[model samples]
Target: MDFNNSYRVDLREMNFLLWEQFDIEKNLLDPTVNAEYNKDFIQQLLFHARDFAYNELGPNYQRADREGCKLLDDGTVQLPSKYQGIWQKYTDAQWGRLSSPQHYDGLSSPYIVAQMIYEVFQGADPSFMVYSGFCAPAMYLIERFATAEVKQCFSHKLATNEWTACLCMTEPQAGSDVGAITTKAIPQDDGSYHIEGGKIFISAGMHELTDNIVYLLLARVEGARPGTTGLSCFVVPRYDLQHDGSLIDNHVRCVRLEDKMGIHGCATAQLSFGDNGPCKAFLLGDRENIGLRQLSSMMHMARISTGIYALGLAGRAYMSAAEYAENRVQGTSFKEAFNPRAKKVSIMAHIDVRRMLLEMKSKVEGCRALIHKLTFHQSWLTNLQALETLHPEKSEQYQALSKHHESLVHLLTPIVKAYTSDQAWRVAELAIQVYGGHGYIKDHPVEQIARDVKILSIWEGTSFIQSADLMKDKLAMGRNSKLLVVYQDQVKTSIARNRKAGVLLVETDALELSLAIFVKTHALMGTWVKEQKLELIFSISTRFLEMMAEVTLSWLLLDGAVIAVQKLKNLEDSQDEAFYTGKIASAQFYVNNILPGVKSKAEIIAKEDTSALDATGDMFLQRTDLYGKQYF
Candidate 1:
C-alpha cells in the first residue's frame, strides 16, 4: 500500500456519528452554546484537518519512527530532521488550542469537535503528537489548581505550545502503586520547595522543541505523612523564571532515553531532579497532600485521550486493510478455481478475507462509536454547565442533566480506554493478516500502527488496571454504583427504543441478552466479595470488563444502526447509501458475532475457575524434571 494512502478515514461515518446518530447540533452546536460552529464550519474544519494530515503529517509517519530521537550531551534530545519544521507548522496552525478555553488564547471549540480533528492529526502521525498530548492536561492542572502567579508563569506557554510539559507521576518504585512514591520535596525559606527524585518513562521529558520543559512533579513534602495523600504537585521547570522572566538552570537533567519497541520518535526519558543543584519549585495553589486529587483530573483526560489515540490508529489500520484487500489480486474465486479460463480476483472476493475485513471494520467502527459517545457526553456536560450559567432560573434542571452526563462519562472512561486500546492491536493485527507478508514488513504502515498502538494498552494504566478500576470503583464492588446503574439504564433504554421501532430487533435482542448476563455477573462478583472469594473476582475482572464493554459497544452500534436505518430512506448518492448500509452491517456483525462472547464470558465467570490461582509457580515452567532436565 502507498504510504500516503495509509492515513485516511471515512469522513461520512464521522459526519453521520456527529450529526445523524448523535445529533450534537441540538445542544452542542446550538447558537447559544457554540455560535460559530455551524455544520458548514465544522465540516470545513474536518476537511482542512484531513488535508493537512495527508499532505503534511502522513509523509512524516515512517520517517519519524526510523530517525527516532537522539540524546545530546547537554541533556536536550535531537528529534527527526523533519520534526522541527512539522512541529512549527502544527503549532503555528493553532490546532493544539482548539479545545482550550478562550482566556488561554484558544478557539474554545466543543470538545467533541476538537477531538474529531485531533483524531485526524493523530492518525497521521501519533508519535509527533505525543509531544503535544500532555501539554493540555498539564495546562488544565495549572488552570484549576495553580495560583495566579504560577498560572501566569506557565499556562500560556503550554497552551500555545511555546513550551511543553509532562506529568511526572511514575518513579523507579512507583508505577500504579502511586502511594509508595518516595520522591521528596523539601521546603525553603521563600515558600518554594527543592524537588529531589527521579522519574522514569516520561514522554517528551527532554527535548529542544520548546524553550523550556515544565515538570508537573509529584513528590512527598518533608514532614508530610507517608503514602499518596502526603504527596503534593509542584511546578518544577527545567529553567526557573526570575522576576523579570529570565530563565536559569534548575538542574533538571535527562539522565537517559529509553529505546522502545515503538513510537521511537517520542523521547521517553529517565529524568533526575536536583542531582547537580537545587530544583526549586512552588506548591500548586498553596495546597498540601492533595497531589493525587489534583492529578486525577489529568489522569482522567489522559485515559480518554488514550482511547482516541487507539481509535485513530485502529481506524487507519482498518482503512488501509480494506483498501489493500480491494486492490491486491492474489487468488481466483472458489467457484472459478477449477476453471482454466477463470481470471484472478482481488482478495476482497474471497469469503475468509471478506470476513476478516468485516471483523476489522466492525471493531474499528465500534471503537470509534464508543469513543465518540464518551466525548459527546463530555461536550453535553460542558454545554449544560454553560446553560446553567446563562439561565440561572433553569439551573436546577441543567444541573441534573449535567450530573447524568457526568455519570455516563465516569462509567465509560475505563471501558473506552481498555476496550479500544485492546481492539486497536487486534485490528492492526487483522489488517496485517489481510495484507499477508507485505503487512509484517516495515514497507507497510499497518505493522508500524500495530507497534505504536500496543503502548496504549500498556500506558495510561494497563488493561488489567482499567478492569480493576471498572469493577471496584465504577461498578462499586460491594454494590451497584449509581454510575453503573445509570449506564445500564441507558443501554436498556436503547434496546427498548430500537425494539419498539421494530428496527434492529435482532441486534437489540442480542444486546438485551448480553446486558442481562452482564448485570447478573456484576451481582455475582459482588457476592464473591461478600464471601471473601476475592481471588476469583480479581482473576476474572478483566474478562468481566470485556463482557461489559462488548455489551456497551453492541448497544451503541445498534443505536447508530437505527439512525442509519432512518437516514437510508433519502440518501440519493450511492456513496451515502453504502455508508449507511455499512453502519447497519457493522451493527449486525458485532451483535451476531462479537457480542455473544459476553454470554460465554458470563458462563466462564460463573464457573469460578480457580486453577489459575491454584497453580504453583513451577507449573508454568517447561522443565520436565526438578533439576536441569530435558525439555519436551
Candidate 2:
C-alpha cells in the first residue's frame, strides 16, 4: 500500500491547509489557547498524527478492504485479522482520543489536527478508519451531555478504545426522514428504560475489535408524541456490564449485514433490540425532547468528516491523474513546428488533459481550504471557554468573535459537505478520463475513488437537504437587513482586493450580479413564506444551494489569489513557485470557467422554475411497450 508515500501527500495537504492557508498556529497561540497548549506542543501532536497514519494505519487499508469482516450465524461479527492489530496500534497510540478531553487520557488536540489525522486515515482506507472515527463522535456527545456517573463509567473505556460506538438513527422506513422512526423506549422501575426497536445502516454496529459496543440509539419513549420532537436518545450497550465492569450477555441482536457498494470493510448491520426481552438503556440527558438537538452536535461533526472524506478522495484522484499525465505519452505538442521529426510527448502537454487536471486541482484545493477553515473555526469555538480562562479581560470580546465565527461555520457546513462531494465525483471522473482505457479497469485507483466518493454526497445529508438548510436556516439567521449588511461588507472587501490585484475583473463583476440576484431571490423567498408557498420554496431550494455554493467558492478562490500574489513576490523555492503558480492558475480557471454558470442558475431561481411539478408518474412508467426501453 506504500503507506509512507500516500500519507506524505495527505500530510502535505494538511499542512498547507492548516498552517499556510489558515495560520492555525497563530490562532492557537491566542490568549485563549495559549493557556492550555503551546505551538511547539501542537506541532508535535501533528507530527504524531503523521507518524500514526503512515507507519501504523495506512499499511493495512487495502488488505482490510479486500478481506472484509464476516458475520456469523451465532450473532457475532469478526473483522479481518489485519485490522485487529492496526486497531490496537491506533488505540494504544491514543490516536482515537485526539479530540477527547485531556482528563480522560486524551490529547485534546485542536480540531485542525484531528481533521488532518482524519484526512490521512480516510486517504489510507475510509472503511478501516470508521472503527475509530465513528467512536470519536459518540464519545464527544457523551462528554458534552451525559451525567457524571455515566461519564465516569464509560468515558475512560471509550477514550482508551476498550469499547467502540455506533450512532443508531436510521430505521428501515425512516432513512433521512427521522420523524418517522418507530423505535420505542419504555421506562422501567430500576430508573433505566427498556428499548425495543430496530435500526438499520448502523456502521460498525457489531464488530469484534471492542469488548462492548455502545449504541447511541434514538427512539421514542412510550406515550410520547410523534415526530422528531418526541424522540429521545439512549445509550445501549451490546453486552451488559456489571458494576465491577465485567461483561454479561445482553439481548441486543444483529439481524443481518448489508451488502454495500463501497467501504465494504466497515460493518453496516441491521440490529434488532429486545426480541428476546427488553434491553436496558439509559437516557443521555435529563431533558426530554432534546434528542434531535443533542444529535445535531454529532451531525455537524459527521458532516465535517464527510467533507474530509470528499477532500481526501479528491486529493487521491488528483495525485493519480497528475502522475498518469506526467508519464503517459500521447499526441505531439502544438509547438512541434520547430522540429520536423517531432516526437510524442506526455499527455500533460495536451491542452484538454492539462485543463482537466488543473480544474481538478483547483476544486480539490479550494474545497480543502474551505473544509479546513471551517474545522479550525469549530475547534476554536469548542475550546473558547478554555481560552477565556487565560484571558478573562478579553473574554467578552472573544465571545462576540466566537458568535460570528459560529454563524460562519453554520453557513459553511452545508456547502463544505454538499458541494465538495458533488464536485469530487467530477474530479474522479476526470482522473479516469486522463487514464483512458486503463482507468476503467481495476489497474488504476480512479474507478475505486470515484465509487467511494459517491457515498459522500448521499450520506450525512443529501445535497438537497444541505441546499434547503442554506436557504432556510443559514439565510434566516437574522433579519434580512442585518444579513445583507454583513454580506455586502464581505463583497466590498473582495471587490477592494480584486481591484488591487487587477485579476478576476470579470469574475468580480459577475459576483456583484450574483449577489444582486441573491438579494432579490431572498426577498421573493420571504414573500413566499408569508404566502405559505411551501411547494414553490421546495422546488427552488436546490438551485438556491447551487447559487450560494458558486458565490462562496468564487470568494474563496479570490481570497487564495490575494495570498498567492504575496507568495509570488517572495517565492524562494521551486516547489513554492509551482504551488503558488498552480494556485493562481486554478483561481483563474474557476473564475473564467465556473463562476459564469451561477448567473444562469440565479435566473432560474429568480423566475421560480417548477418544471418538476408538472411531471407525471406515467412519464417514468413502463413506456417500453409504446416507445421501447431504448427510447433515450
Candidate 3:
C-alpha cells in the first residue's frame, strides 16, 4: 500500500473562485462583518494549506490505511501509530479550529478560506480528515447549545483538539430513520441522566487519540413522546469528571467495530452505553425533544463536509489519472495506423481521455464552486444577523438580505451534498477507466479513492434522502417558501448578464436552457404537492434533485468561465493563460456534454412514470434462468 503525492492544488482556480467568482473580499468588507480580508490573505493561506497537505498528511495516508485500526480485547481502538502522531501534529497546528469562532481561541477564517484547507487535507488523505474534520463543528454545537458550566468543562479542550468527539445517531435498527432510535436516558438527581443504549457505525467513536471521547448521543428520556419529537441530545463522555476533578470511567463500551470497505484508518465502532449500571450524560442545553431541530443545522454542516470529502478525493483521482495518462504510452494512433514510422503518444492526447478528464475536472471544480457558494450565502446570512443586532434602525433591510442568503443556502445544500458525492463515484470510476487495468489494483491511488468515495453518498444521507428533502422543503412553495422561484430568477439574471462572454456563449445558453427545464419541473412538483400526490412526489424526487444540481452546477461553472474569458485576454503569463484556459475548457465541456442531462431528466419526470409503484410483489420475489428454468 504505497501512497503517492499526486494531489494537485490549483491555486489559480482557488483564487478565481474567491476573487473573480465570489468576490470574497467584498463579502468581508460588508459593513456588517467589520473584518479585513484581501486577496493576499487568501493567497498566503492557499500556499500554506498546500504545503501542509503535501508534507504533513499525503505521505501518511497509505501507511495508515494499510495499518488500519485495531480494536483491542479490552474494547479500546488504536489507530495506526503513524496516523496517531499526525493527530497531535494537527492539534499543535490548530488547523482543526480554522473555522471556529475566535472567542474559543480560533482563527475563525471565513468559510471558503477554511474550505480550501478541507479540500487539500481530504484529497491528501481523507481518512486523516475523518479523524480531525468533525472537531470544530462538534465544539461549535457545544459552545452554542451547552450550559455555561458544561462549556467550562468541554469547550476549550474540544476546540483546541485536546479532546476528540463522535456523533452517535445510528442504531442497529435505525440508520437514516432517526425517529426510530430506542436509546433511553433515565434522569438522575445530579443534573445528569443514565444513558443506556447501543449505536452502530459511530466513526471515531472509540479512539485513543484524546484523553476522552465526547459522544453527542441522541436518546429518549423517560416518559417522552414517540418519534424524533421525543428524542433529546446528550453530551455523553467516555469518562466523567469527579467532584475532586479526577476523571472516572463513564461505562461507555466499544461493543464492536465495523470492517468497512475503505477509510480503514478511521474506526467505525458500535458503542454500548451503561450496560452494567448507568452512563452519565448531560443534556445538550435545557431542551427536551428538540434534539432533532437542534441537530438539523449541524447535520447540514456535516453533509457539506461529506461533499467536500467527495470533491477532494475526486480531485485526487483526476490528478492521478491525468498524471498516468501523460506518462503511460501504449497504443499507436488509429489515424496513423498505415504509417509504420508513426510513434505512440501519451494517452492524454487521446480524445476520449480528454473527454473523461475534462468531465471529472468540470464536476470537481463545479462542485467546489457550489459548496463555496453555499458557504458564502451562510456567511453573509451570519453577517446580516450581526448587522441586525448592532443596527436596530436598519433591521428590515438586514432581515431582507439575510432572507435572500438563507434561501440560497437552504436550496443549494442538498444539491451540493448529494450531487457532489454521486459525481465523485462517477469521476473515480472514470479515473479508473482512464488508467485501464492498472487502476484496479492497490498499486495506484484511484482504486482506494473509488472505494472511499462510495461511502460518501451513503454517509451524510443517501442520494434519495437528499432528493426528498429538496423536493419537500427547498421547492415547497407555500406562503413563505419562495426559494425555487428566487433561485430560478437568479440563474436567469446570470444567463442574461453573461450573454456577451464569447467562448462561454454556448455554455451560458445550455445553463439557460436547463434552468428553464428545472423551472418547468419545479412547477410540476408544486402541482404534485398541491394535488396531494404523495407517491408522485416521492417517486420523482431524486430526478428533481438531479435536474436542480446539474443546472446549478452548470451555472456556477459558466459564471467562472465568463470571468476566465476576460482574464484570458489580459493575462501576460502563460501559466495564467493555461489556468484560465482549463477553466474555460471545464465550463464548456460540462455544459455541452453533462448539463444537457438536466433537460432529459426533466422530460423523464414530466412523463410521470408509475411503473415502480405498480410493480407486483412477485416481480422481485425470485429469479429464473433466461430459459425459464428455476434453480430451486
TM-score against truth, every candidate = 0.97, 0.92, 0.96
Weakest ten-residue segment in model 3 by summed lDDT: 28-37
Candidate 3 lDDT over residue span 335-377, tens digit each: 9878888899888888899889998899989998999889888
Q: Clashing residue pairs, candidate 1?
A: none
Better of 1 and 3 by lDDT: 1
**Model 1, range 1-632, lDDT digits (tens) per residue?**
23444678778889988988788877468788769989999999999889889988889898888889998887678998788998888888888888777788877788899898888888899988889888888898999999998999999988887888888889888998999888899999988899999999998888888889899989999889998789899999999988987999999999899999899889999999999999999899888999989988899999999899899999999999999989999879999899988999999999998898889989988888888898999998888878888999999899898889988898899999999999999998999999999999988889999999999998889999999988888888837678878987888888779988888886787788888888898899889988999888889888998998899888888998898898788776776788888889988999999999999998998998999999997767757767778685
Residue 521 of model 1 has an lDDT of 88
Could you say which candidate leads in lDDT? 1
Error of 3 at 106 (Å): 1.0
Clashing pairs in 2: 32-387
RMSD, every candidate, angstroms? 1.9, 3.1, 2.1
Winner by TM-score: 1
Q: What tens digits encode model 2's per-residue C-alpha lDDT throughout 381-401? A: 877877677779989987987
Ranking by lDDT: 1, 3, 2
lDDT of 3: 0.84
Q: Which is superior by TM-score, 1 or 3? A: 1
> lDDT scores for all predictions?
0.88, 0.78, 0.84
